[model samples]
Target: TKPKSRSLCMANPSAYNYTTDIFTAAALRWLETGRTASKPFFLYLSYTVPHAGGWGSWPRAPEDGNPVPSDLQYAAELSWPEVERDHAASVSYLDARIGEILRELERLELSSNTV
Candidate 1:
């Protein structure tokens, strides 16, 4: 059945991580359920990393602070070059998490037949 609305279960309206987390959670849930154990599944994991604008604000503090600004706040205050490094770091973190999920699939012996 088609979704009646864009919002699916617990959706966060304030950050991109929320979207990425939702997709990752769904994928993990499907992998956990061995019910459709034999069927080939196509997982379209769309992540929202590295995309600026919409929802989060990036600038409310100085750019040269010790701890640095929060991810959302940093993105808002600085220019592209300044924010790019932090954005790249955030993407790297997401990639690592996704890699871990893939490793889990391989461990379950569901990578081949379940793909």
Candidate 2:
């Protein structure tokens, strides 16, 4: 058998959007206008974060290539190792995106019914 590829989920190749933003936007779109008004919907939204180690561009050092939008906020944590800071930033970025989805659910008055 052939060995599997190392890249599980590569980052977005575009400069303007990160992978998280793309997935989050899709979830938000569904919550906002893509769902059927007569039926309940199930959204299986997944995110890639703290694991930006997936293959992509070299905007920063090889260890810092995750491309998370919140990376800059963690850049100030000088006491921690660079890789750790990058991981934290990725997680924080994911958290904010999830918050957006949750807020959208609330806005649509579906939070009480959603799991």
Candidate 3:
């Protein structure tokens, strides 16, 4: 079945920022609602980083200076020198957010009983 929310930002190759935003939000929600006494909660927090069309794809004209027209920014046409750097940064941002959630779990003493 198709997803109910087209909210999967990872599908947008140019929007790693969007993917990170979604991951963090979901992690927060999972932490809030996933505590139970009898069963271990399983969270599947999938991230769409280093996906297609992200900063990992190509460097567009700067949004503030000498910006190219929107119509001219093609992923197939541009060569970005820092694609790996951009991907790494995106991954790091999401990792940090996950760390925050794990820290909260530890603080609440949920790791021992619930994991």
lDDT of 2: 0.64
Residues 8-79 of candidate 2: C-alpha lDDT, one tens digit per residue: 343433432577887887788778885544567778986766565833443343344554444556644334
TM-score winner between 2 and 3, please give it.
Answer: 2
Candidate 1, residue 78: how far the Cα is off, in Å: 17
Q: Supply candidate 1's per-residue lDDT for 82.
A: 49
How many clashing residue pairs, candidate 3? 4
- Provide the global lDDT of candidate 3 against the true structure: 0.62
Query: Which candidate has the highest TM-score of all?
Result: 2
What lDDT does model 1 reach? Answer: 0.63
The TM-score measured for candidate 3 stands at 0.51
Local accuracy of candidate 1 as per-residue lDDT tens digits, 1-115: 3354544544653342356677777778877877254777777777767574433344354445444455556455554444645776777878976986789788776778654
TM-score of each: 0.53, 0.60, 0.51
- Residue range with the least summed lDDT across 10 consecutive positions in model 3: 56-65
Q: Which stretches of candidate 2 lie over 4 Å from their true place?
A: 1-15, 34-38, 54-78
Clashing pairs in 2: none
